[model samples]
Target: MNTRLQTQTAEKGPVSVIAGPWPSYASFRSLPERERWVLYGSAKAYREALEDQGLIMAEGYDDFVRRVTRELEL
Candidate 1:
């Protein structure tokens, strides 16, 4: 268990257990950063819409770049 995971778990409660396959790392990474970010942001919205939300998106440094690209549709 990573320290961040521990902290988030403590703050937000337990992690959700997802049953379906997550998007592939390559599919996610190959996307332009901004494009990816937009997609991810939309995905986050979708995730939150669920009655039993389980998605956790803890983005790193590249996250912003990805988000911008996705948002701009570049």
Candidate 2:
């Protein structure tokens, strides 16, 4: 098995750390910087990839897009 997967399996339990591995970037952004790094460090590759793509969509999909649109002047 992959080392990463093995580590994850070994730690299969209540996640004490609250960080960017959050469900969404909005959640990650809501957290303090230290917490964000915690999440980034522990987040699954898929999530990190999405974040890298600059494709964050907060809970309310449409609303999040609208907000980004207005904020970015896009």
Candidate with best TM-score: 1
lDDT of each: 0.50, 0.42
Model 1 lDDT, residue 64, Cα: 40
Every model's TM-score: 0.36, 0.26
For model 1, state the Cα shift of residue 49 in Å. Answer: 1.2
| Best by the lDDT measure | 1
Q: What's the true lDDT of residue 29 in model 1?
A: 60
What digit string (tens of lDDT, one per residue) describes model 2 on residues 1-74? 21111112243542222122224444346566676555555544654465455434233435544543333333
Q: Model 1: C-alpha RMSD to truth?
A: 7.5
RMSD per candidate (Å) reads 7.5, 13.1
* Span of 10 residues, lowest total lDDT, candidate 1: 1-10
Clashes of each: 8, 1
Off by over 4 Å in 1: 1-18, 52-74
